[model samples]
Every structure is written in C-alpha cells, then in structure tokens.
Target: MSFPRSATRSALALAGAGVLVLAWGGSAVAAQQGSTTVEPAGAAFSATLDGEATFETGPITVTCAVSASDPGDGNNLVPDEPDNHNPEGAVGGPINAPNFDDCEADVPLVDVEVEVADAVWDMSMQDGESAVGTMHVPAAGIVVTTSGVASCTATVSPDADVDIEGTWTNGDPVSSLAFDTTAPIEVEGGVGCPDDTEAGFTAAYEVENADDADTPITVGP
Candidate 1:
C-alpha cells in the first residue's frame, strides 16, 4: 500500500549531510530510550542508526513494523487422540473428516520474531568514513537495511531488550551497535541526526513527539 502523507512526514522529518538526533517521546526509533545532546557542525554527535549516508535523486519512503501473536487456533495441526487400548477404533474420525488423531500430533506453533536493522538517511555527500549513530531495539532481533551500502547489524540477545549501546565515528571505528529484544526495554523511537538537515532541504522524518494522533515527522523548509 502507498504511504499516507502523514506517514510520509513521520519517516522524513530529518535529512542532512550527516545528521544525528536522539529518541523523542515514545515512538519506535532506536535511540528514543535515551537522549542525544546536539553538537555544533562537524562536532561529535552520537545516538543510534548508522552507516554512511546514501543519496537519492528523489524522496524515498521506508515502511517498517514489528508484530507478534499468540499461537491461537493456528497452533493446532494434529488430530484428536484416540483410545488405542480399545479394539474398536471406528467410533470417531479426524477433526475434519475420516482422518484421525495421527494428524493432530504433528501440529506445531511457529513463533514470530522480527528485527529492523538499519534505516537509510538520503542526502548528498560522498564519504568513506564519518560520524555514526546506532540505536538498539529493546528486544533480541537483527538489523536489516532496505537501501544503502552497509552491513546488516544488530542481534538482540535472548535475555535483553533492545537499546543503543553508543554512537561511533565511521572513519574505521569499532563494530556497529546491536539491539537486544529478549529483555526489559525503556526506549522506543529516536532520531540520529535531527539537526543535520540535508542541503536545501528542511523537511525530514521524525518519531511521534507526543501522544496526539498527529503525523510523526514534522516537515519544514
């Protein structure tokens, strides 16, 4: 489905050469749990969500969501058990038809686990190394990038929720930060480069600042 104009704003409220922002209120960005102090241009800024900034000819939209559900009826696959001790095995059949409990024993519930690794920040600038922001989800998960040139990072451990460990400098820095999804978490949405607006562009995506039903990203010019 196409993104609504409001949703578009939520995803593009911040854009720049190498922007860095902290998680706002309770949204879903990785760095929302903590906060990032803004710095001067070319200054050091660290939050979450990293890798080199990629440029695009036009505006690009990325849709992301996390979901899980109880096994529910979908968990049922095997048939009802029968009285093997009795010689008469013709009283009832399978749940749907002439089948039997043999099928029920094979049913298994498949759990759902989702992880969003990297988000792309489109702007103009070519660089091999620079500043970096890394955000971690409060759960054990993996990071996956839809568009960009970077590694798919973040693997939440089984006992830890997600959280950004720290930001880094790109010019040959330590490994990227990873999110933990299997434990208690305190943060949600955040921005790595809120002040770093793209050249000639004032509008960019942002996390939901408040609990109102308004758009998440606020566009400017």
Candidate 2:
C-alpha cells in the first residue's frame, strides 16, 4: 500500500521521536513460560524480508530483498526479560540491510542500510494470531547509510513498535515480523541534507526466513 508523500514524511519524523524514553525509561519485561534450544555459537541466524516499504524521502516501490541477522544466542521467543534497559529484549543482532533497490534508474537510489545496535523486539503472542511488541534500538543507536544516486549518512535515535495487524506468514512457513512507529526521534547529525534539519522518518520492517533451516528460535503458540 502506498502512502501519500505528506503522510509518509509525517510518519517518518515521528518514528524516531522516542529515543530518550528508550534510553532512560524502562520497558515492560516479558514473562517467560517455555524453554527452547539455543542456536549454536558463532552461528548467524537470518531471514529474507521482501515487502513494500515507504520512507519519508520517497517510495520504495521495488520488491527489495532485506536481511536481518542475530549473532547472539538463538532466538528467544519468550525472552526471560523484555525490558529495553536490560538484555532480555535485546535478542536479534542487527538488521544489515532494511531497505534496498534492485531496479535501475538515472539516480539509481539504492543500498540504504540502517545499522541497529543490539537490536531486539519485545513480543507478545496469542492463539491463531501473530505476536506483537516494540522493536528498540538504543540512544544514538541507528546509523543510516545510502549509496548509488546520492551518497549520504544519517545518525538517528529511534523507538518503534511491531505493527501487529500487519504481521503474517510468508512463503517461509513461519510468520514474518512487521514493525512501525511514529514517535518524535532525533537526527543527531547527517550529510547531504541541510544542517540543523530535524529530519523525521517512519520505518517499517517485514522480515521472513531467508533459509529452510528452522527459525533461530520460536515465538508465539
């Protein structure tokens, strides 16, 4: 679904608004109820994400291929702890490339990767329903780098949520993850854009299994 350019910009600006809350305030801790085998050490579990995503600057209409990897312990569905200030909620390693373009163009705007530090999601589950929660990256946490047409770098502070209703299963069998939020975020600094510009960006991620292997860990029923 395409969003109007005006709305897209508004959402993006709001996406990073909560960097302070995430950094100082604490998040709800997830209760643990089950046990699952952890992934092997040094093993990187990843998923292939292909979906329609819109950014504040422009429309990402291309069917881009995105990948997220977790180098830490295997996925922890019911994280022993789900607080942003703690380690429990910090599960998924980091999403390497959240947005990219394979199509050709004069400017060839592509290769937009947002590096999330110690990325993690707080998930809640229900029967026959996809899990939902917040995806947090700490203070001064996100760095967005773009290549091709115009090269630029943006350092962002973001606090976003997993858009529950949009979560669903893809060809990967297991359900995919989707997140969105429009909080007041901060753009610490950036290149290419005007100085002192508090550029806002609404971010969404649709992650699916990139391989046949079992999901690093399981969540939900």
Candidate 3:
C-alpha cells in the first residue's frame, strides 16, 4: 500500500492518535474470558510519531524526523486472539501502513530511505496489564536504502512473522506505542552496509479513535 503523504507532519501535531488495528473489522462485543482485547472495536485510528524514529546497525544510525500512521480502514482492537506472546492476530495486518518522512542518516552526506513491505503480514495485540502489539514485515522485511555520498541496501527481516513488539500504556490508549525492543531488529546489509545483523529500530506513537478523537481505545480481559 502506498503511504499517503499529507504534506509534512510532525509527530507532535498528531500525538494521542496512534494504534494498529486488525484489518478485518470486528464486533465491539465485550471480550471473552482470558482474551486480551484492544477495545472499542470496529473503529479506525490516527497515529503520530511520539518522537523521532531511529534505526541503528552497529555504528551506522538513521533517523526519521517525522512519521504517521495512515488513517482509514476502520481499524480497531479485537478480543483475545492477538496472542501478544506469538504476535498474530486473527487475520492480515494492522489497519494502516505507517509513513515516515525527513529520514536522514547520521553519517555525514549519506541519505536514508525506508520502505515497509507490500504483502500482508499478520499482527498480534495482547493486553498484559497494559497492551502490546507485534508486527512483522513480509519476507522482504523493511528495506532501508542509503544513498548520497555512498549507497547501500539493508533489510530487517525477522525469521518469523508477527514479531515486531509494540507496547501501550496501562489503560491509556492515548499514550505512545513503544517500539523499542530488548533485542535488536536484526538486519542484513550489503554494499558498504554492516555485514552483521545487529540493527535496531525504535519509535513511539500515540493512538486515538479516528471516529472520535476524544475517545481512547481500551483493553479488556
């Protein structure tokens, strides 16, 4: 999916409106026992980068100054089955493709470009006191292209799907979805890029109801 760019936006301008929802809109029925649900189901959301997005592979670092989760698709939180441990929701993908802008490499004169894959990769959201969602790019993973003084290709391909971990605050859907992981987002590179797989990615986003900005998504069971 092409990430629809609406001029350049700062993550601050649209904070408190970020969430990854199941692609297949679900019923708002109360969650079943033992099921972790991202509540207020059947709603879409808006998300802005809580801060700058960063990707690092050893000494090389790339940062995006802005990013947003595209709006639409009636995305919402379904009950249980997101299996935060496994990171697989019932079906294909989060509601929108996240878009990034003003990305630059920390290395002088080197430029950075990132692209999320186009295939359907399942996502899993789980509630553990707070909330956690896991996502994985298709086999292609997320491609980071570096150009300018030098050019290179790097891919952050997780061996398994539904594995990128994102966390939400306890009962605070308005808080940022924390995407910093204990483990690096493992990467493989070529053409002057690092040969080892020690890449890391981190971003924070706040989620709000697309239909009702004042309403925050909640977790149940």
For 78-171, candidate 1 gives per-residue lDDT tens digits of 1122221112211111110000011110112211122332221111111112212233332323321111211121232324433322222222
User: What is the TM-score ranking, best to worst?
Assistant: 3, 2, 1
What tens digits encode model 2's per-residue C-alpha lDDT throughout 91-186?
223333222333221123244554454444323322233333334434434454444433444554444432222232332334454533232334
Model 1 misses residue 199 by how many Å?
A: 27
Candidate 3 Cα misplacement greater than 4 A, ranges: 1-33, 73-93, 158-162, 170-173, 182-191
Give the TM-score (vs. native) of candidate 2: 0.41
Over the stretch 10-96, how does candidate 3's per-residue lDDT look in tens digits? 111101121100010111212212355555555555667877777554444556777666455433333224332233322224555
The candidate with the higher lDDT, 1 or 3, is 3
Query: What lDDT score is found at residue 98 in candidate 2?
Result: 27
lDDT of 1 at 40: 15
Which has the greatest lDDT? 3
How well does each candidate superpose onto the true structure, as a TM-score?
Answer: 0.17, 0.41, 0.68
Q: What number of clashing residue pairs does each candidate have, in the order they appear?
A: 56, 13, 10
Pairs in clash, predicted candidate 3: 17-46, 17-47, 17-206, 17-207, 17-208, 18-47, 18-206, 18-207, 18-208, 36-80
- Cα displacement (angstroms), candidate 3, residue 208, comes to 0.9
- Against the reference, the lDDT scores of all candidates come to 0.20, 0.32, 0.48
- Against the true structure, candidate 1 has what lDDT? 0.20
